[model samples]
Target: MPPYILPFEKPILDMEKKLEDLRAFSQAQNIDVSFEIERMQNKITEMRREIYENLGAWDKVLVARHPQRPYMLDYLAAMTTDFTELHGDRVHADDRAIIGGFGWLEGRRVMFIGTQKGRDTKSNLERNFGCAYPEGYRKALRLMKLAAKFGAPIVTLIDTPGAYPGIESEERHIAEAIAVNLRDMFRLPVPIVVVVIGEGGSGGALGIGVGDRVLILEYSYYSVISPEGCAAILWKNRSYANRAAEALKLTAPDLLKAGLVDEVLPEPPGGAHADPAAMSATLKAALLRNLEELDATPVEQLLEQRYNKFRAMGVFGEDAAPAPAASPAPAS
Candidate 1:
């Protein structure tokens, strides 16, 4: 299958194609071109570095949305053992977009939950392009409650454009489903770790994003609104999505600096899709380390800190307007 080429990746792809042709020609003619191949390889490395090193927020968005980027199941397979999937909200049908189950991470048994996006057209349709309905949120909460009941820590992977916004979603009360999760997650006794592994869009991501340690992959974005959605609303055109991405400060680094994200996990060079195994390893280590830290705190203290962590995120500042001095004098 052909790779999904983003707009900015065209140059890099062109260089790689030339390098491939050179190698093939050398082999066909039975000639030694190893020196040239090495030189070209070095050039390609620098090319990738230069491009990735200076990526803008919009560029990072493209990378985050890349079709081949590792999803929740990929991370689960890489980081856990003894995986067992649990399904259904018990009140509604099972939602495939948001999947959760029990998995052994490192030396401890933990509950794993995350939004899953599909790899192809068929799967995307099945996953509804990673948009969850009310049942998805309810199912996630059910899983979390189960984890808490078992005295196990909870790990949530977030990646979605937003909650499903179709008519059926409203009919099922999507907002209420997410609101309940947001409220209940804060009160859960077990430690919860949330990772924004990809496009963390609006209430979709937030439905299950609460936790003690909120981490984000370097290229992933977490925002109340997607850039395109914001652009369409604010600029009246989706083409201004790039500008909206910049203004939203949704990138991992941006969110970290703004105190919205606890930490930013650096992706493998050229982004996560370029080296999924490496990215997965980094994610595994981070999850274990954060989980270890949370485990050390008492349950009461953990819940307190978890609530405060999110509370602290809503920091607001309002400049008090100058009193109507002139009007007061006139009244006097």
Candidate 2:
């Protein structure tokens, strides 16, 4: 299949194609046009840099959802070694939407868990488009507990539209499953690192999102709710998703400024999809650095700091002056 192209990327791709054709023609004619081709290549680089630098929230949203973007399994394959996938929740059937197992990272044994989206239509159906059902969350929690017990650090890669909203998921108590993971993750004695590799939406992402250090990729988004869902709820139309994205402050810079994310890993020139190996290298370095720092802390201090880290999120309007004792409302 041809590579997917976003509207904003058309011009860049077109210029690149034209440059390639020019170079081919030059070679065919046995002419010396190396200088000219180099000049055009430089121009294309500058244009791409400018476009990526000034991308608006909507552009970022599209990038985050780009079909070619590397998914969880992609990262795992690129960044880890000796991965042994363990399956089934034990209480229910295994969910393909979320997968977890033990892996070797920089010579350290760690538990790797993430929401898995398929690369094609059939696999996407099987994975429910990366939206986890209740069992998925249960399985994640189970792996996390095992990690904690065995003295393995936990690494969670979040990329999901949201938790599955199907009636069957609700009937199975999806919310409760996610909530349990949230509560248990905080208390784990081992170090935990989380990265938002792509679309981090709502409780689906949060189901495995809690960690000592939370990182987001440059173009990835982490939000309580997806922009399209928010648009539908507020304006009764999904087309307003772009505006909704702006309003939600869900971008990496926004979240970093708000203290929701500890770090933002830079992506390749265009985005992660443009160069998965480069993106994976950056992610691996950041993970190893953070994990090293986290490993040096005492378990007591680690747990306490992790607790305070999450507790510090959100804005609390400065304590309002206590209202003057309700002025004798009883007289009425």
Clash counts per candidate, in order, are 0, 0
lDDT tens digits, residues 99-140, model 1?
Answer: 999999878989999999999889999898999989999999
lDDT tens digits by residue: candidate 2, 234-318: 9899999999999999999999999999999999988999899999999999999999999999999999999999998878678
TM-score of 2: 0.95
The most accurate candidate by TM-score is 2
Clashes of 2: 0
> 293, model 1: CA deviation in Å?
0.8
For candidate 1, the 10 contiguous residues with the lowest summed lDDT are 323-332
User: For all the candidates, what are their Cα RMSDs to the real structure?
Assistant: 3.9, 3.1
- Candidate 1 clash pair list: none
